[model samples]
Target: MGLLLKTLFYSSGFIIVWAMVGYPLSLKLIDRLYKGEQLKKDYSIQPTVTVMVVAHNEEKVILEKMNNILELDYPQEKIEFLVSSDNSTDRTNEIVTKFIKEHNERRIRLFEVILRKGKTNAQNEAQKTVTTEYLVMTDANAMMDKNSIKELMAAFTSNNIAYVTGRLSIVNQYVNEVSISESRYWDNDLAAREIEGRIQTITAGNGAIYACRTSDYYDFNPIQCHDSAMPLFYALQGKRAICNHDAIAYEKAGEVIKDEFNRKVRMSRIILKHILPDINILNIFKYRWFSYFYFGHRTCRYLLWLSHLIVFVTNVFLIKESWLYAVTFTAQVLFYLLGIIRGVTKANNKQLTMIYYYCMTIAAQWVGVYNTLTERTKPFWEKAESTR
Candidate 1:
């Protein structure tokens, strides 16, 4: 029993450390080896593309999003906007309708739902209005760069490329401890996705800005996260999904830690319930490079909380075995203690804030796991108030 416990402790510790530190270093080291080749521009190629924006009570940012889309570098004649409102009680529909009237162009269309279905349902209903060859799916709150659409379309140079996701830039307008840590998280995520895309198909797309072939788009399960579901669906069809670093969309970070935690918990539950089952397409024997990228960038990441828990619990059992074990156990306890302190006091230290965020995120994932096991998490979407 003692031998087994010690072995488990060391093994879990090694994995946790490797994931936290070594894995990122490895990616950076091998980044140049798999760097994606730049595609030559064909100025004469103009594909008809539809931009779909799904909103529920998004009156705050809907107008800005519309204006952003209208200003995109893509040809207005070749591009169309499909704005869907999922039973918005607020002025969301009215605002979109006003925009359509003001534009007075056949390019802008609005689909208002009377009943509150979920985002997936709204997206599916809106997709039927799309006659374009390419689809650009974006959130109402995310504003795109002027050339984002053009950059995304440029990647569709080959038929084998099923989807192209844009870079998500977390704009911390109101800088605070939570915002700083959240920015760091997004930076790391973007880096990993860039590297993964260079190596092979990326694990998923940023919900803010992503494009896919209209023919390849499918109505996903309402319970599944659209960002992950769409990418995995394309992968299963033997199509490649790449991220266009040049295409950028901006979004605000969560101002409050609790709001971010709740968001992550919901996301974790959806990933565990829906995304995990679809990962079989990334079989090592079948899809060699993609399998390595997916497991390294996503699967192992999802299981990190479990690895952390194992290390902590096993460390407790081996605390008195040696000075090294005692130090390791003490460090774990102190790190958690600092997290609690940062939570209660709301300290501004970047390192402590990151640790607090990490611990809270793990706690949130545990709750998400419980919700998944009990089937308590529903398909309905809840907007994080802090981000809004």
Candidate 2:
């Protein structure tokens, strides 16, 4: 019993550390050996493209988003804005229609999916109308950098490139403690994706700034995130899904930690549901070097909640074994204590709020795991309240 407990303690501890630290370090080592393919980026070429914005109830930002797209640096005639409405009952559809009529912008179009089957379903239904070869998908609140489209298209310099995702920056990162921590989290995420992109394919892409050829776009399960699934989806076919950091998009971070937590829960659950059923990822012979990264970046990090739980549970059992164990256990307890204190007192201390946000993140992942286990995952999209 003691041996098993010790094993659990050490093993879970390593996973918690590895998911947060070791994976990025290993990627840095891999970077030296992996010199990815050279790009033949040509800024002069303007391929006709469709910007697909999937919205549920986005009246708050729909018109502004349309304006942002209109002001983008892409050749005006070469770009088409396709707004895919997922059974939106709000003024989202009306506002979009009104904007198009007021400007007489033939380039802007709206399509609706009344089934409420979710964002993926909405995109799938709307995709039938896309006449362009390459499609860029963005959230309604995501504002593209002036040269974002050109940079994304530049990365697709060859047929071997499956997709190109851009870096995301939080426009309201300094709004609050939650936003500050979220900004830091995104910085780490962008760094990780940048490293993985250097390996020829990224593990995943986000909806805020992701682009792929219309022909290569998979009809994802209604419950799955294309952002989470498409990078691997294209990789399985020997195509590179690269990240272009020069192509940037800005989104407002949720002001409240709990709102952020719920968003993470939905994301984690959706990612797990999408990845677990695909046995192709485990076929090392097929994925080759990418299988190593998939395990390190996606699977290990997704299962972090389990590791956190095991480490916490086993720490209580092993506290009597050594002074070192006691010290470590006490440190863990105090970390949670700080988070709780800040939550209860609404304290303005920077350090404690950050700790609280981190704890809420882990807790959300645990809830995601619970939802996945209980078959409670749904095929509906919920926009963060603070975002729209």
Candidate 3:
């Protein structure tokens, strides 16, 4: 019994460490040791592209989003602006129609899906109507740089490079300490994905700005988000889905911790509940590279809360056995105590709020896992009011 407890304690500690620090460093080391697949870059490849702005009751920002896309630097003859509305029962459709009527030379069109299916479903619907060579899928809230689509197109120099994701920046990072914490977390995430792409296929794509070939786009249900699921899908097909850091987009960060926490809960549930099985992640013999990276990128992080729980629990019983165990127990207690204080008092310390944000995010993953396993998860599109 003692040995079992010790094993669980040590193993869980390793998992926590790996998820926090070891994984990104290992990726860098592996990349340095063995340079992975290189993408052939030709900056002049501007193919016919369709920009699909997926919207769902985004009346507040739909007009701005349309105007944003219409003003891009891409060729007017080559770029088609598509406003894919997922049964938006607001002024969204009206605004889009007005924009189309007003900007006929910009080649803007609105496709309204009658069903209020989730984001992926809306993408599938949009793809069916795409007669272009490349399709760039982005959120209505994501404001792209003038050269975003041009940069995304430049990466598709090789047919094997079917998918390309862009860099996303939070526009309102200083809204509050919580926003600052989220911005920092996002920077780390973007760096990790960039390194992963440099080594091999990226583990996931960014929802803010990503482009894929019309022919290679996978048609998945609403339950599976294209942002995370498409990378695995392309990997299974022996294709490359990489990150182009030059393609930039900006989005508003959540104003409060609860808003961001709830958004993570919804996304984690959708991806964890169906992504593994839907893409056949366990078929290691066939998709070995994908299996390895997905584990490092998602599986480890999603299940990290379990390891943390085990470590804390095991340390409780082992504290009397050794001074090391007692010290670890105390440290863990203090760490969590600070997080609770941050929660209760809503502290303004940037560093302390970041720590609190980390803890709350870890807890959110467990809640998502619980929601998925117990069939209580809702895999649908429900935008956070705070973000809008």
Clashing pairs in 1: none
C-alpha-based local distance difference test score of model 1: 0.81
Write the residue-wise lDDT of candidate 2 on 1-388 in tens digits.
Answer: 9999999989888877887899888887777767654445778757899999999998889888988888888887788989999989999999999999987855889998878988888888998899998899998899988899999998887898898999888889988888998998888888878877776678888889889888887788888878877888788888988898899999888998767988988887765554344768788888776787787788777767778788889989999999988998999999999999999998888899888988888889888878878999887747788976
Q: What is candidate 1's lDDT per residue for 1-388, written digit by digit as tens?
A: 8999888887777667766677777778777665655443444657999999999999888999999899999887899999989899999999999889999965899998777767878888888878999999898988999989888988777788898999888887448988888888778877877776666677788789999888888988777767778766777667878888788999988898778988888778765644255657568777656666666666666777777898889888888888998999889999999999998888788889989989988898888888888988776667877776
| TM-score of each prediction | 0.94, 0.94, 0.94
Computed on alpha carbons, the lDDT of every model, listed in order, comes to 0.81, 0.85, 0.84
- TM-score, cand. 1: 0.94
Pairs in steric clash, model 2: none
What tens digits encode model 3's per-residue C-alpha lDDT throughout 194-271? 777876688888799999989888888677788878887788788888999889999999987888899888777754
The Cα error of candidate 3 at residue 266, in Å, is 1.1
